[model samples]
Target: MRQPLFVTALAATAIALAAAANLPEPSADIKAAVAASTRTPANLARDQYRHPAETLSFFGVKPTDTVVEIWPGGGWYTEILAPLTKGKGTYYAASPWPDGNKGVQNKQTADAATYGHVKFAAFPWAEGQPKVPDGTADVVLTFRNVHNWRMGYQRGGTDYSGEAFAQMFAMLKPGGTLGIVDHRLPESASDDREKSSGYIKVSTIRRLAEAAGFEFVGASEINANAKDTADWPKGVWTLPPSLSQKDVDREKYVAIGESDRMTLRFRKPR
Candidate 1:
């Protein structure tokens, strides 16, 4: 039987994006980690779109380097990362506060075997000191978080996004990699959308990273979702995972899967 048009289209998008990203093939350990049983089944199901193994490989994450993940909302990637870096390296989940994310905290206690060694702490906010020691981290990763940083500043008085980049820079070793993945807004979209919509422009992120003294490393489309146009009743959340619109056009948005994302890599000067 012939394949459906939508399926063919999505496959084409993945192919083109992968080519554009120049993503490295996943290392054996990285692939095994992503496939590890420690990861949540729900999170694993999303791997079709997230491509965790390839994405991390693209960022050059290793087993022997200290890694700090900023704002690991509910420990999606944390499930894979914490165990991957165990013993050989360190994994830190830096958020606003540990109490703020009790879900991960409880998981740490309940599943000590996987999360016991993971360090959970506060992110350096509003000129605060970085919880991750300065000049020590080899890789700092943030997934789908840049938009929330914009929201923080737009709603509050602080420039959280700007501060986040600077703080990340402070914690990284020279030649350290800063890997960021977030929903992508079209460059043609009005600037105001960035504050409300969950999507951010690639230029905006590049500007912030460059301002923080990071050298642009490269980009990967390992998480791109072309069906999403970034114009939703509830922004990027209108897609799967959140589906903020509820049953209204549910199938339509579900067909779109996740939001289109820009996977960016930057480096601190050696």
Candidate 2:
């Protein structure tokens, strides 16, 4: 049955609103953070592909929010997030290896003046007491770490990825957001590829998040790359940055740049 014109118009408007830009432009603080001089030139160069400003804006980060970054390998986002939250907010580099993970630790230590306010929290979470505390964080961001969590578990004493999602869910305030960016595997790809290659299916990610009590808020293509094929002899590492296949097809992989990625956001229901 056809609805009345007013009802139909309202329905269309709702759909359009849902499809529009989920959040506003990054605040001046975030833009300044991206342009901060503390960041190394090499890390700055990757800005074209990473689009740190746009991604964080889409995640709805604010200077006053308490943010946690999961498994911040090499502290790539730390250069921006740490100082962005400094003085006005709290930023925690949540890692499984608090003391052992040198990448973020060294980055924090080396730039104490800038990252001085940054805190470290054990992720995969400790048993005694939760590090960040349940229902406390305003935002939790994980960049390209989902596949590693899936791979870390052997045959299945426990599911690391599932646990990670549950922990993240617990640590978020009701209505808080979780932003994720990871290599995307096409829905057409075989399931086994997710276990071997660094790429993961969007469905798998949604299932994990939803099961952990998060509602799918929206997705963005801000970090999408048309050049990547998501197939390599040595997996996604065969691409630049890692370039695991060094010199074999260095030119080819360099041209491809980074893997195609999915940017997703979920909300802990209020």
Candidate 1 segments exceeding 4 Å error: 1-21, 125-130, 153-158
lDDT of each: 0.83, 0.82
TM-score of each: 0.89, 0.88
In model 1, residue pairs whose N, Cα or C atoms come closer than 3 Å (at least 3 residues apart or on different chains), thus clashing, are: none
Q: Per-residue lDDT of 152-206 in model 1, one digit per residue for the tens?
A: 7434844478888999999999999999999999999998999888899999999
Pick by TM-score: which candidate is best? 1
- Model 2 regions lying over 4 Å from their true place: 1-23, 153-158
Estimate, for each residue in 94-201, the C-alpha lDDT of model 2 and write its tens digit.
Answer: 876445347877876787888878888888877763388889999999999888777664325334888899999999999999999999999999988877798898
TM-score of 2: 0.88
lDDT of 1 at 166: 93
Residue 13, model 1: lDDT of: 49
